[model samples]
Target: MAADATKSTAGRTVFRHRLSTRAWHWLNALTVIVMLMSGLMIFNAHPRLYWGHAGANADPAWLEIGATPTEGILKVGALTLPTTGVLGRWTDRHGVVQTRAFPGWATIPTDYSLAGARRWHLAFAWVLVIGGALYGVASLINRHIQRDLAPSRGELAPRHIWRDIKDHARGRLPGGEAAARYNILQKLSYLAVIFGLLPLMVLSGLGMAPGVDAGWPWIVDLLGGRQSARSIHFLCATALLGFILVHLAMVVIAGPINEIRSMITGRYRLPAERA
Candidate 1:
């Protein structure tokens, strides 16, 4: 029995990453998290997206004023109010009853606090943008990006990509290849989110900032104007969010515990058997 246990442990394979890669991975995760939380808070500030006209256009139908912004504060109003008295009652120190607004067809409880949300969002934005740039430059210098992240020639083949997809779908990924890093789909996704989408979000966000047009007028021109930049920024944020959702789903499908451990430690244990 002891011999069998020892054999099992010996059969497992472990991989270690250099300190730079580990630091970059963790910091990237941290900044992305900060961006997500603060971005959601910021989105709550606007709470609306317009297409042709300002979201506040008088004749808008597909998008109506979901919340009335009064006193520089916005709320979600009737769209998300409690039904069936599930919110319960609150009592003041004086024993007076405090009630939640019961949402009806015409009225929903609105989300508010634009000023505070913007402050938090802008603050975290600085960290993400600066930190990401530094990480990118460092990765280039160390060749970590080229060596680890860039797809291999084998990964470029349609057959290899298809095989990875099938394995991902069927939960039958091979365990032997430690050098088998990210599959094509994963490489593409990481590239899009890290290189393309994130930079766009930061640039568009900065373009929409008040007085930015004075220093970088072309940014406004590139995005078609300040308002248009805001729209694009929001769209980019949505894309990043979608990627995060898909990533989480893949982790869950692949084996949540093991995947999470690999991310945290930068090492994954491979099973003994390989055909």
Candidate 2:
């Protein structure tokens, strides 16, 4: 009886997150935060948006009537939506000047350091890119990507995807040995972040970097130009931020305590149904 009890308890397992995943996740989070904050400061320099303008023109409209921040132009494939925050500025004829403002929102004061903002932005960007590269290479070498991060062939089938969708819709998820491992949703999210959004972010950023034009003129040409690159960079950053929110929501829905513990301590107690 005792032996059976022991076996049952043992089978009621406590699955732990691999140390590498915990390290990579937190590092990615921190570096991305730094990049986002510094990027915002840098963006404050040119808070205006332009449909098309190589340089200034004599027309009043060409004078950039107001700053319309590109923060809300989120796009992936063909879908597009107005996101959050309309960055702008206003200067009253009476000589009162304001940095940023929206219809019913608060006004933000502007700073005068395009050079410094660019420097800080580029510096933090290096951390994000370098850290992400290291994490990717390390995951490859450690078999972390292959073992836990990739979705199974069967999981990629329409039936499995439909089931996952159904489960997700109902706020119920797969558990068992399957859930102990990352499900297809987790795998796809990781893949999209690492392969799709992250790389696009880095590339778009590099396209805007001044020195890059000398050697990689094609990058700038490919993305349009420096200003266009900046717009794309902002769009991708917003998408990544949205993904982070959904990721966190999933963790919470799954099990907040266990999820937080896994991230902090690299250990998660597998659900009861998981073996």
Candidate 3:
């Protein structure tokens, strides 16, 4: 695996992604999908979030997704919104009405099965943990983190970061040889998901487990409490979903052929710099 993307053949093509990176990426994609759908089904069992140490139906909920006889509503604090066709209420495949927070098509098993969803979610949770650990080791061994992900001091400056943000807002994507390497925004976003968000998600998840809470009490305390952990976990999952959507959009906008090829075959054709 090459530390940095290298150009050859008049610098038109570069070894963009390593085999390990490609493998982990695809595996992570599958794991995340299963985890998300199953988790959503689990959420359907209790479509409300609270704070502090304990929460119940009678407790004050910071967020709630439920249905009335007429329609479905999602409430965050005092703000409430109707979500009928997609969330909180929808028609099932059998033409039956569902009042779950998420639709059947969006959940694992495609039916209301908390036990089944937990089976899938817990099974994939191990994969996420083990696969992420292995990828971290591989990245360090290949210097992928240092060479590609680490931003230079100059790149970390406020002006430099602001410039990248402005460029993205203006749709001025990188091209030419510059396309081979990650820009500052890419590096920061990747780092956030890889290190900060993912790890926090795992810890918060562990806090939600009774056995883990009993044995490793500090894990729950570290996150304030079980209800707090649950809220954080939900927020983190939402953020990760947003990141995935933006990532897919970028892949489509930045030439899907080249972008998808790099992830699939570890080879990328560097786009020539824009005028």
Candidate 4:
């Protein structure tokens, strides 16, 4: 009985994130935050979204968020919603009124400079792509993607997946040895962000670049068009933001100090099971 219990608790205190993984995680986090903010600042330059091969001031937009003479409005497919201080109209740091899609606080540089924002966005974009490539190679070499992120055969069953979802909803997190490995839901979310959203973001961003489009015109064609790529980039960024929110919430719920420390130091203290 004692030997069995010892085995059960073997992974309660163990190395969770490797040094390379932790480094990549923090670097990616910083770059993603900077990119998102700067991207928003860039978006304010053209606060409209469209579909198809080409869209300009003359063409119709599928979505638009801007300030009219009367109020700030967000228009989507014939629906117009008022967004006052948060979106269209706001008091600036100088106590003067200003109109912008996203407020200064939510943007990089905190001042309206489209050129500065684009520089920041493009500079950090290379950091993200290069760091992400290194991380991906490291993960593959270490089998971290295969062993930890990929779902196991048992975890793929509908019943198993549903059970994990229910457990997560109820805050019934795993403990003991089970806590050492990521849960099915965690695995799926990581995979989606790392493999699906990140790549799509990179590709769409490239498709929007004039230099890239000039060299590889097929990229824009493959993604439908420049406008389509822009729309996809915005959507992927939004999804990444959603993932970050949920990830932070889970960290708080699970154990902020432990979870954060694990990412920082690569050591994790698994939560002990309760009676």
Best by lDDT: 3
lDDT of 4: 0.90
lDDT of 2 at 112: 48
What would the TM-score be for candidate 3 when compared with the true structure?
0.95
Better of 2 and 4 by TM-score: 4
Over 95-200, each residue of candidate 2 has an lDDT whose tens digit, in order, gives 4444432221211113445576567667767777778888888889989888887888898999998888888888886554445677888888889999999998
**Which has the better lDDT: candidate 3, or candidate 4?**
3
Residues forming the 10-long window of minimal summed lDDT in candidate 3:
1-10
lDDT of 3 at 124: 95
lDDT of 3 by residue, 118-236 (tens): 99999999999999999999999999999999999999999999999999888888876778899999999999999999899899999999999999999999999999999999999
TM-scores of the candidates in the order shown = 0.71, 0.75, 0.95, 0.95
RMSD of each: 7.5, 6.4, 3.7, 2.0
Ranking by lDDT: 3, 4, 2, 1
Report the C-alpha lDDT of model 4 over 60-102, residue by residue, as the tens digit. Answer: 9988898888688888889999998778777778887789888
**Model 1: per-residue lDDT, tens digit, 124-159?**
678777778887888899886798779888888999
- Provide the clash count, candidate 4: 0
